[model samples]
Target chain A: MPNDTLLETRPVPGTDKTTAVAVRTHALSKEFGGRLVLHSLDFRVEPGELVAVVGKSGCGKSTLLRLICGLEKPSSGWVEVGGERLSGLSRHARLMFQDAALLPWKSVKANVVLAAPRNGRRDRAAEDALEHVGLRDRAHEWPSILSGGQRQRVALARALASDADLLLFDEPLGALDALTRLEMQALIERLWLERRFSAILVTHDVEEAVALADRILLMDGGRVTFETVVALERPRDRASAEFTSLKEAILERILGRRS
Target chain B: MATESLSYRSRLINLAGPWLVPLGLLIAWQIFSGSGLIPRRILPSPLEVMQAGFHLTLTGEMPMHLWESFQRAIVGLMIGGSIGFVFGLLNGLVGPANVLFDSSLQMLRNIPHLAMIPLVILWFGIGEPAKLFLIEIGVFFPMYVNTIHGIRSTDPKLIEMGRIYGLSPWQLLITVVLPSALPSVLVGLRYALGIMWVTLIVAETIACTNGIGYMTMNAREFLQTDIVLVGILLYALLGKLADTITRALEAWLLRWNPAYR
Candidate 1:
């Protein structure tokens, strides 16, 4: 296994200051009804880093994201955000799910505004977030009328509206069709580049991992068994040899373990 | 010319589509009653019923009875509906409240609310309270059951999303849970409206001195079948009106829902 866990505590590329760590888990483990789902493990995410966790279903990828977001408690170890131990649901973390769980009763902008920080100008925040997702015109439309991709965009805008430092994505694009998936991937990358919130995306698609992640973690049997950093430049070419090779290597590792 | 005539026919059907069945029935009824196929004392002609309605309306007698019935239904509905709403909210959101109330309420719901009429009369006599109590019992269950169903039907995913977004418990109930429950709640309200009229009719006919039901019973004593038919038609019309109002409420509240839209 090529272990490239060397990048640690590094300052984000565009930012000048060495920011605090976005998330850190010390021997984190979780079990449900005496069934161990996530084994004891250590994990870290740097500020502004986009970490993608790719694994087969039920391999604890979703559980890892849930634990990081404090939706689930660690059965053994503790999770830290910004170097502070998390006691409950992380106030600093925002989560986006695969279903784009927008409130069906609220307008698109109202849905976004519901997540806006209370102390700020919520309406303006909602407008800015919708504008970022290119959904300014759809602010007044019901979520039910939007396409699947557009709903996810609104969900993204909602997460963005809340000025959280960490964003946990649980297979946010898994439900979209191929073309829409590509468009969403580009949009996510552009937004991540612009905002630079530390993001942990749990996905099954290795290509998506290669395309979007700063570092890719492969989990099998409830443990992070392989780690690699994507050193590719911005606007990475999927057709390029480096991208294909990296994608193939990860797919092989995942499928290789299945047999 | 053929296509144009067909289009004209279709346009006319579109204009009169909803009235066609009722109009046909009315015409057939008029012919049968006017031709003396049925005894006038048993089932009066539609025209006679209309005349009775007009006479009652002109004398302001019908309006007074309608006002009394309307006032009773509205007051009973307000009290019963609020009680059901509060209880349903508690039972739906709180585990202990559900455990304490759900099964008992379900048991009570199985018994016909009309069956409690004798007991209600015994408790409150033939006064306004007796009529009000019957309407309250009739209206309570549908609202309670539907409210619980609505709250329980709320998508768990949306609640999780709300929490992750830092919505307080109160905010979650207001923004996510309540909106999710609105459609089901509206359905309950419509069902309750039906029960309200049914209860009032029975109570007024058996005991009350005023209301549409009392007017029908009074007409029975005088053998004025026309007035009786008028009262029956009034109930049907009021029921339809209640349904329309409930539907409009659904459309307004659930405009975001594609089904309602």
Candidate 2:
């Protein structure tokens, strides 16, 4: 399927110095009530890499994210983050969900602060994170008053405020409209570029994976079935031939075509 | 500008609507009683009720009854509400607690609290303890049921998020679980307030020598129906005041809730 030949050889800008591995999963598997949801799989994410996992519904993408984030225990096998084995939720990693999940009782800034570690400069860090997501003015407003897009932005700010070394996105932009999705994609790209934190985004949208990731993995029947790397440059042109071809290649793998 | 004026006029009418009927009834009673169609002994006029209320207030008799009743209600509410809250939290969060206490409490809840009065009196006698016991029993069930429901019905997604964010168990209760359960808890509190007055009235009428209930009972013996009416009015006013205060508290605490806004 030309999978080995498709690995992008392009050097990631501003990330050459760090040889640190951010995440490593060895033969991970999960089952619920005797039915297997995630098959034994080996995976690794290098520091500052943005990896995308794409698959259809019920294909174990979300389960993989949950396991990596320590929200779910593996039925067997182990996960290592920042070179240490994870027991429960890893302090080095943060997760963003599709639902935003901001505490409705708290103000936007307080929601961000809730994820931040206690310190003298905690509020300053939260404010900076909110400013990064362009939500500085909305810091004191309740989550209920925010629009769906704005709420997601606040959720992004919350992840940023956490200051975790790795970020997991579980279809965080799946609920946005077309225009908002594009805006969020750009914002996510900008933030990932600036912070250089390792990120793994699990999404159903093939074009989004091409637009945002350094590499993309396709999962099916509870295992990674296809892998490809995006060779395009940052601020990638969606209308460019490379972008379309890359998206087409991922789509073919997802659709079960051996191209 | 015209629409603004129209809305203003409608707002005024809305504000005045509730009072109009009561005012009309008062005026009609005064006119009819002044004409002497009905004997004053059978039904004292509204003026007589007001005068009795005013005279009682000036003599400090009404204040004494009111103060005694208020103290009892507050003490009972504080004791019963606190116990209910703690039990609810325990049962809702811990599986063993739920298994041990929930069913027993539910079974006990089904029995009418008023039905326990004679037993309560026998156990505690016709003193302050008996009256307090009745009020406590009356208020406890609603608070307990509501707190359990509130804690149990908290959104699982939010709790999951709290775990992911590394919130401690206490933080989770304070931030997510408690706030989510607040509306239901407030509803329970309002319900308990109504029951408190009802229970107190029954307890006082049966035996007490103080409180508005005792005053009403005393007036009934001498056929001082005006004073009796005044006592009833005082109960209605107190109940309304409690409801208003509870509503205001609910609004302030739940200001972040979109449904309230």
Candidate 3:
């Protein structure tokens, strides 16, 4: 356990002390009205591992994200982040929603500042995050006035601005147009390289998982059916035969596996 | 400047929309009365009503009556709306609290609030309190329902985001819940305000000595159709004024909403 190992790694960023494990889940099970959603789900996300979760519709991938993020309580397991229990202490991570969940009453800057400190450093952080997301110019505008892509950028900024070491993305770019989606995916990859944080991305797109994840967890019938690790280099060619073969392999595994 | 000109034209059209029916009715009424198609006493000329309206405003009597009714309605609205807002917030944020009051309150809300007139007067006498109570009852329910609906209707995903960000419950309420609930709450308030004015007339007619409602009642007794017409016009004016203010305030508060954009 990372919880026991946290003391060994000192001088933790954003904390005076250090933590062993960034995130740990043990036999995490979730059910709704006796219908099994997630069963005996045990997973460990390293301090800065970027994992993509791919699954068919209604396969409990989003539910796993929710459980990890503490949005929904687990039926019979524990989720700990950076050596702290999640149930009592609302985990200080951030989630980027498909809807961009920006409070419609606040300006872009205010929305970004919502999770930041209330001082000079916080202001600088928010400004830097917006700049990083390419929304610095739209910081003062209402979210309602922004384009769909711009709004998603702001939502991404809000998540990235959080001091937490973990980020749970629940199909944050599923609603974007194709052209914008490419730009966003590249930007997200760039951001991930710059900011080393554990990210668990829940998405339906096989290509998205292959393109972004260091390791992809393929879930079927509320269980991890296959675990795939991309050995391809960074900025990997999407059209390369190797990439196509990998995608095909994952697809076959997805199609072949039956509950 | 280009967009502004187009917007100005649209603004004029919007303003003119509501007046079309009233303006046509006015022309029809004037022609009917002037041509003796309808008896003067029966239809009453628009000119006569206008004259009466002018006289009532120019003199202190009608103004005083309007002020009295306005005062009663506003006071009841303030009290009733405050109660409704508190209950609504409680019902929204606290599950057990909502369960405690929701069903019983819902049952009580079904009774005709207007029919409480005799009982209100019996308990509180013919004083201002009785009339105010009646109007307050009218204002409470709509505001309460809207409050609960607004609060409960908040997006769970956003709320989860707040929690994941380590937001305290109070922080959650102020940041996420209030903004989400605002549109509904404002709508409820507008409905409550309109009903307050309506209930004022009923209460005033039953008990009060001087008000717009009392003025209309007095005019009916004296067979002065012109005065009655003036009172009705004043009621319409006040109701429209209240609605316009609420609409403007809603625009100001929810400026970030895409519907407004």
Best-performing candidate as measured by DockQ: 1
Ranking by lDDT: 1, 2, 3
| Local accuracy by lDDT, each model | 0.90, 0.89, 0.84
Off by over 4 Å in 1: A1-21, B1-15
Off by over 4 Å in 3: A1-21, A89-92, A118-120, B1-17, B35-37
Tens-place lDDT digits, model 2, residues B1-261: 999999999999999999999999989988888678867777788988899999999999999999999999899888988888889889989999999999999999999999998899899999999989888888999999999999999988788888888899999999999999999999899999999999888988989899999999999999898899999999999999999999889889999997776
TM-score of each: 0.94, 0.94, 0.90
DockQ per model, Cα: 0.79, 0.64, 0.58
Error of 3 at B234 (Å): 0.9
Q: Quick one: best lDDT, which candidate?
A: 1
State which docking tier applies to candidate 3: medium
Model 2 TM-score (2 dp): 0.94
lDDT of 1 by residue, B1-261 (tens): 999999999999999999999999999999889789988998778998999999999999999999999999999999998899888999999999999999999999999988987888789988999988888888899999999999999999999999999889999999999989999899999999999999989989997788999999999999999999999999999999999999999999999998987
TM-score of chain A of each: 0.92, 0.90, 0.89
From the highest DockQ down, the ranking of the candidates is 1, 2, 3
lDDT of 3 by residue, B159-245 (tens): 876776667899999999998999999999998998898788888788568999999999989999899988998999999999989
Looking at model 3, residue A218 earns an lDDT score of: 92
List candidate 2 stretches off by more than 4 Å: A1-21, A257-259, B38-42
Number of backbone-clashing residue pairs for each candidate, in the order shown? 0, 0, 2
